[model samples]
Target: MIKNIQRTLIELANIHRFVMRFYREVFMPPYEFKEIIRQCYVVGWKSLPLISLTGFITGVVFTNQSRPSLAEFGATSWLPALISIAIIRALAPLVTALIASGKVGSQIGAELGSMKVTEQIDAMEVSGTNPFKFLVVSRVLATTISIPILSFYTAAVGLFGAFLSVNQNENTSFRVYFDQVFDAVTFLDMFSLVLKAVVFGFTIGIVGCYQGYHSSKGTEGVGRAANWAVVMSMFLVFVEEILIVQIIQAMRA
Candidate 1:
């Protein structure tokens, strides 16, 4: 068991190394622009509705849940401000990261894992086509490109949801609610939030490709890779968030 665990770790590390090298190679000659764009459509645009729906519902629920607590202390006026802080600073990015990790990360892992099991990747290599460059690089580039757009859409929809929820009790216009919301935002908030989302996207792609590429060539191995990709991405996303928040706090001080 210990040997198996150790070997798995080593395999994962090697996969990461290959992915990074492929990423470097990707930017070089004979760029696979078409494949990258196709991946963007698959990983980004297809996933937009899911991210937007999740973000909107989350914001709406958060506002509804927190209203009574704030109202009890006669703090109703702070609703808009708190909602903005939550979305712009933490909630928006965190939720969007989770969504991307599941959608993009799992898809990358499963797709590569399937190809690996079917020997298609080996076939590409034999045919003198760089499988790593064609597959891994395209997906990673798609992920990196897609995440920011997804976050922007999610944040906007989430704030809109918050507005709808606030209207449940408060009699504020959309403009007024948004004014309070955006009023609380600062460069520190936006910077950390956006930076974190980008990193989170990179993490999802790297980890997913790593697990899938190195998994043994079998259906069971493919399933295991897919499962573990989601698990590891979630863990990494939280770690990144904590580190980012600490850095932000330090900068503030």
Candidate 2:
């Protein structure tokens, strides 16, 4: 048990060092603008369809499930406000991060692990190229920029889905439903959404890159790296969500 704990601690320390190095290299000279843009296209644009689908489905299901409970208290009219607040502040960010973990995280890990296994990364180093700066920095920076944009898109789509669900039973117009949603959400709520997305994005990128870059030397190791990337990214997302929520609550209080 002690050995296991010590190993975990060591791994955590290594990950911290990796992250610090990433921060230092990310801002150094010779920014890879072309690579960053390509990564952004791959991460951001390629992810929209999945994120949109998840958001819409989440909104529909949440609205349908919550209606009965609200009806019990004669608060059925509060559906839009309730769903909007929940989706914007929590559900959308969490769901989007998880989805990105499965999609973007896995891709990054597999790609890098493959490169590492085949020694392409080593060849890049021999050719006077900083592979870490070119590959890891661009991908992580792209994730950091992409997730917040995806979160905003998810919130908008989710609210629309909620509106449609509410309209099935009542005659709430788009303007009225949106007004309720906007009224329920404050600046604090918006700030929380952005903050969570940024943290989650960073977590996903760093964990994915760390796992891939340090993958063992085999085909099996590549698979392991991809799997670990997704699992660790999702785990970190929840941990980060908890900490951010606490901090936000304290600030509000």
Candidate 3:
């Protein structure tokens, strides 16, 4: 157990160094605009359908589950406001990031790990092409930008789904439901959620790229990289969520 703990600590230290290197390289000259755009398209556009579906189901399920308890307390009318706050402040960002970790994170790891094992990365180095810039930076940037947009999309779709669910059980009008929801949502709520999304996005991208870029020399390593990418990204998302919540609370106090 001690050995395992030591190994984990070493790996974390290495990851910190990798993050520092990424920050340095990302801001250096010769920005890869086209590559970044392509990655954004792949990460954002391709992930939308899945995000929408997940958010809709989450809203429907959450509404259904909470409705009974609220009804018991004669507070069913509070559904919209409750659901909106939950989704915006936590559910949408967390769920969306987890999905992206499994989808985009795994894809990044597998792609880069395969390249590593096949000597493609080495070939790029030999050919004087900056593989790190072309691959890692672009992907990280794409994820950073895409996640916030996806969070907004998820919140919107989730509210829509909540509307549908609420209408089925009650006679709440759309405008009134939203007025209740939006009235409760402060600018702090939106800003904090977006900030969380950005952090989650960065964690996913950096973890995925780090795993893939440093993959061992075998096909099995590619699978391991993908697995690690998803696992680490998800873990970091939860950790980040806790930290952000504490920070927000402290700020409020």
Count residue pairs with overlapping backbones in model 2: 0
Ten-residue stretch with the least lDDT total in model 2: 162-171
What would the per-residue lDDT of candidate 1 be over residues 149-238, giving only the tens digit for each residue? Answer: 788788899899989988767988899998999899999988987888888887888888877887786899999989989999999999
Q: Residue-wise lDDT of candidate 3 within 143-184, one digit each (tens)?
A: 999999999999999988999999888888989989988998
RMSD of every prediction: 1.8, 1.0, 1.3
The residue ranges of model 3 lying beyond 4 angstroms of the native Cα positions read: 1-6
Residue 65 Cα positional deviation in candidate 1, in Å, after optimal superposition: 1.5
Alpha-carbon shift of residue 48 in model 2 (angstroms):
1.1
List the global CA lDDT of all models.
Answer: 0.87, 0.93, 0.93
26, model 1: CA deviation in Å? 3.9
Q: Give the lDDT of residue 110 in candidate 1.
A: 91
Top model by TM-score, which number?
A: 2
Decide which is better by TM-score, 2 or 3. 2
Per-model TM values vs. the true structure: 0.93, 0.97, 0.96
Candidate 2, which segments miss by more than 4 Å at Cα? 1-3
